[model samples]
Target: VNLRSFEQAQLVGSPFIATNEKNMGGLPDRTDDPTEEIIDDLVSGRLPGVLILDPIKAGVVAAETAIKVHPIRKGKSGVPDEQGCIDMAYNCNGCGNCQRNCPNDLDLVEGVRLAKEGDFSVLSDLFDYCLGCARCEVDCMKEVSPLTLLMHAGRERIRNETFNVRVGRGPIQDTEIRNVGAPIVLGEIPGIVAIIGCASYGKEIQELYKMAEEFLIRNYIVVVSGCAAMDIGLVKDDEGKTLYDRYPGDFDRGGLVNVGSCVANPHITGAACKVANIFARRPLRGNFEEIADYILNRVGAVGVAWGAMSQKAASIAAGANGLGIPAVVGPHAAEYRRMFIGRSDDDDTWKVFNARDGTPDQLVGPAPEHLLTTAESIEQAICLVAKLAIRPADNSKGRMIKLSHWIDLERKYKGIDLPNDLEKYIRVEADIPINMKEEVHEYLKQKNWQPRDIVDPTLLKRLCRT
Candidate 1:
């Protein structure tokens, strides 16, 4: 199959659907011809992506698909990847296209070779950001579906191995946020730190851990998912303690929340949606654009995907953008083939329309200039994360929190001087801290930054019917 053409066809709003099969006793048994089942599903246009839920059946699928399988070995008595699973990779021609196409540059050929020899440990770590987007499958010269390999590998490693795997912790619901009252007065919250995305971090992993710790200490609510969550748990501070071990795992302020695997990522965006509908009392049922506009103008949330790769990562970033939440990607994101950077100074670009009404009055100034951006380094990513979290509705304390980190990160990485036009977000002198008051005031004056009051600070307050 020409997967790119197939994806393009699907991209043009093709009505492809996903379906999970029901097996006997709630566990799918190994079928004799798993590839035939997969092909049948594909031809039926009901399987956009295949999710391997059964470990035993995963091997059957892996063998037919000719991909590496690493099902999580279950309990202490669980057996390793079966010998039949190893024999599946005998047809691989040692091509490196799959690895290059992978977001993390994981060598699937070697991984499969290792899996065939019963040593699944070598490629077990590659599952962190296995988006299952099927790009690797299309890249295979041998026409093997690589994601099925990932699922097979994951299933084997998770079900058969005796390693310490981070168990999936379902989605974060809106009621949970309401119970903690974080969404009630979101403006008072400094920022919502969404530490999400792929696990392709370099030295940035250490910096990401410190950044999360800093935000937590500064009273920002931190949320995580996918391999990013796993990476955060794996890091240790100078004192040799992981943030996951030290911090309270709550959804409240200053709490670090890991909302499970990639599929559960909607919970992060769902929390933002609830802020507009539940706390702010805006419409939500069929008003996705308006709710997203409210989030852009009012909610102080930013997504940081330091190691983003895969088409699924792109879609996640795009989804966040559509919801008015901006996402910052790491250096490796450049390999994702595109980045969306908005220019703040451009008046034409800094505008949003109220989808409810086609009137000019309901049009609002864009709260944020960019929806998705890429950082060159870890320090830059931290700075961008702090900057992206700043919204038009931020309170004085919230502005102070965001600016402090912004300036500190700028000084640490770029220079002591703040980036040009940062004063646009500084609503008042009171937003500056007492310690940096002198320096910031001097810089603002030098840049001829005028004191401008933001009247009608609500970006999407005006509502009109079409």
Candidate 2:
């Protein structure tokens, strides 16, 4: 089930799929939009059914959508985005502070005012500019939410708009698992990057294409889902090839896999779990602890949600983090005000237990520096993805190659040829790229880089036989 559109993604497998912004109704806590009828089946874990009078939208949303709300004019500057969201008793005072808070410089006030007057052109046009950070609502003194106005106008304009889209491809195929599994274990594949999130980065969606290409060219598997998948497809090269047309839709090295919609997000992590079952011959049931440990130490995967704006994006990122896979969220994600940050400077933070035996290892280096961190730029995010892909169980050759790409990306994007702290991950001469051996040797000497012991690392404390 490729999630065709958020505006009309009704499902039957409980309300789990409703976590996406597009599937924005049927939640127990959500009561403001009382107009929709809740399907008892979806709530009771039966067949997935649609929630009528959806808070997200009323009809199907399509690509290449063009809307005109009629009678365009300059709207008032002081109005809150939603007409009833603000309390008039507090007095707005016409400060226009919310406009300044927006990262994309969208005039939420004007868009709301125009929408109230039935002129949706400004609102419709501004939709591309709004990343749904809800900063306007946050910074406002009277608790005004601009996202509501955008959603309202969008629903009103797109009611009858239903475009033919290929249905969702429900799961990551077993063949894909079989094809990519061994190389991943052997380190031929440095990492699997799941690029997700909404169109919240606004007009800068091309950054996704460039970032995906950088990894794809290096033989990294790139996976995408939901609106971010659609947005990335919007960009094309001079040859008129989107990333989709350029790469095979395989879960292999250098392949591009689109799983369709946030509903398929489980498949992203499920693929990781499948690797343990299908590739390593691990027990699938009653083996979560061992499987999670394997993923953390050996899977060499990271998630990049560069334009995460909604609560659903945050929830998804947190879920991935909980499973021992690291996630890098966009700057707007910082507003969530919660992230598990690791101190790479402190040696103690990187230590892990060798669960396969009874021995303990000291300072394995920052394979995953942070479980969930924010990247301010596309370059930083790209480099972060490379850095996070370093796993405790990576072989010497794999580590060397992964480090080479990370260094290259940093040099290309941030203009620094070598990371300031590079010695922690250098296990041996082979771990350093042959070209940079001398330079790295001198650098490691200065930093007093003591080669740390890494043999059969699994973070599960219970597995230690001591």
Candidate 3:
């Protein structure tokens, strides 16, 4: 089941039906609070296996379970002091520092001030988007915790009322990508770029559309979920139509696929799994190890959570990395305390199973040095994402496409030369683009680049827990 705005829910369509009848009739103009009605459905077991996308609703369910909450470790910048929002609300000078520094652009100073006057609704949406990054705490001169204030407001708000939404088609089927011949016959289209995560970063939605547009124009498949899809939905073209309204939904080059809400996230990863099972003809039904190894070695896919902010988000990242698909998180993810970083210089770190004998062996470092790493900005992420999409299994065409973009981005943003070992991905002279052939050849010559061939290049892990 889904719970978001009516329009947001309808975009999901089939296989997922809205639980609330009011969704079809449009929201009712009732005096009754919506949250109360939802609680009734959940408690009475009317809605089974409901997926909570809205953080507020998730919090409400947690509260009802009487779970002790620790949003962040104690004594972080944004916890309540001896006196909390009730006492410190008056101290907000309205300098707007909190709002300015907020990645999501929430009007936190105003929300806190209003809460003090007995109104908590002002910040309701903001709390829904908050990642608890505590960037606001660093900006607040008053030492007021916007995180604390938002939580108090959320607790109070949850007790009162909530909004209604719809449940649309759940997630994309892996069979779909198979029909399109993905991973095999992948063409010049390099890989799958899944841009996902929270909207709390306050990034202008247009930036996301442009990002998708860039990759789409370049023939890469772009997929979105949750607020990232919503961000794209918010942008309009010269015709004043959103990408969701304008673009065709397909898992192919220049096609934008919106895989519904956050719960549908697995479908993004599922695409990679399909590449192994369907296209590569690997076993998948229950053999998790073989499938993950195939994906890690063969499929060229990467996930970017540019605004990950919650524990659930962390789990999603962990799960993806565990599957051997590396992910890139936004800088704020540093607060999450865990990022899988691989050092290319440390050959010992590049351990993979040579499926030839199902024995662990040291392989050359993969294109992306890390399974998961944080990017300081979207520009860095765009570059990192392109680089991450390179796989050892890439043909000369795929390698050329990936390397060109990675080289251009590195020059454009970081203004650095390509690392000597980067030539390891260049299997042959034809793999290098004509424009950069000499430069790449020169680099390769210095590194004594040797052509290493894998008779059967499937990666395996010593241990894989389904």
Candidate 4:
């Protein structure tokens, strides 16, 4: 019941694991017990940060947690040495620890008090002001994160009064899937890149937009959701056009699909499943392994969570990997203490089960090379996405298109030096770009490159030739 540990899972699971019993049966039916109450509040929002909320909400430690220099609330005109109150003389009961710990400095305790009295309209402002930083949890004796009080309040208000919530738009439509199916299958487009998660503070907003536009110009299908969906639209050109304003919101080359809040993430990944269903007539019901296999072998999809400060975004990135989609997170992602980076140098690390004979085959290639990895900068992120988008199922033309972007981004960002080990992926002369064909040939000749036969890939032998 420390309640602090729940912070990590808050981002992705809170939606399905909600508070009010009626509102999805309340993940645990959040009772008034201090621990459940704190979890109640925690479930209301999803933001990860360094300053964990004050868990010692019921202890004296709260008094010394913050700067201890703010006006007391109306409940207590606190005197110096007053029990459970700061030294400042004021009418508040709390030590103002929640206020100071809040990144936006909102009155979290007051919100809770208001909810108890059934006047939760005060919490409306918290939605915008609260950046989801769970900093308020420092050392609560009762072990509760004051950060989640907002959620508990929201749930209480809703349990008393009913309101209509809008249904989120989910999944890629059949037509849009059909449209991008050919481009993705044929490799006419590099890959479908989904940029999701919150915007990191102080990071240049335009940097994300530029990365997306880079893929857009290269004709990579870009899908954005959650706060990242909005960040890419904050910057504009001389024409006052943001990426959203300039590009069509479709699932095709040069299209920018903003699929709404984090709840709509299924649409982005759903598009991948839809590809197998719509294009190849693969059944969509309860077929995860085969569908995942199809995506790994053929679908050139990559997820770039450049600012996934929350565990929900981390979960989304993990979910992407579950589907064989390579995920790239920002440099700060290393703090999560988990990653799935492949060793490009170790040949054994690149083995794939060639279902053709239920036998393992060594791929002298980097097909979705690393499942998950950190990117230090935007340039590296761009190059990495393109690099991971490569798969064995890519026809000559498909690999051709993907490699062009990978090589171009490497040269553009890292400077005129071509990407290292470019020979590992090029199976035949046709896989090289038309303009750079000779240069690639020269490079391949020096490395003694030989053409490789494209194999039918399947991790499960059930689908292989008997």
Task: Give the number of the best model, judged by lDDT.
Answer: 2
The regions of model 3 sitting more than 4 angstroms off are 1-169, 182-187, 204-207, 237-241, 351-362, 416-421, 461-466
Measured against the true structure, the TM-scores of the candidates, in listed sequence, are 0.65, 0.71, 0.65, 0.67
**Residue-wise C-alpha lDDT for candidate 4, range 343-436, written one tens digit per residue:** 7777676666665665667464568788899888988898999999898778888888888889988999999656768988987778888979
Clashing pairs in model 3, backbone N/Cα/C closer than 3 A: 12-168, 12-169, 13-168, 13-169, 35-162, 103-201, 103-202, 104-200, 104-201, 104-202
Instruction: Put the candidates in lDDT order, highest first.
Output: 2, 4, 3, 1
Give me the displacement of residue 295 in model 4, in angstroms.
0.5
The sequence of per-residue lDDT tens digits that candidate 3 reaches over residues 322-359 is 77788888776788899888777766666555545665
Q: How much does each candidate deviate from the true structure in C-alpha RMSD?
A: 10.0, 9.6, 11.8, 12.7
User: Predicted candidate 2: what Cα RMSD to the true structure?
Assistant: 9.6
Tell me the deviation in Å of residue 343 in model 3. Answer: 2.0
lDDT of 2 by residue, 1-466 (tens): 2243332223111132343455444444323333223333333434243333443432321110112111111232222344443333124434567678777778766765555555667766786667666667666685545665665556544355432222356678778789888778656698999988885444558778788899999999888888777777777789877788788877888978888897788889888888878988778799988888778778888988766466788888889887778999988788899898889888777778876676665557677888999988888999999999988788788888898988888899999868997877787677888778888888888888777555667676776756
Q: Model 2 segments beyond 4 Å from truth?
A: 1-104, 108-127, 132-167, 461-466
Residue 293 in candidate 3 has what lDDT?
A: 75
On the 0 to 100 scale, the lDDT of residue 25 in model 1 is 26
For 51-94, candidate 1 gives per-residue lDDT tens digits of: 45555665555454432211212122212235545655555677
In candidate 1, residue 91 scores what lDDT?
52
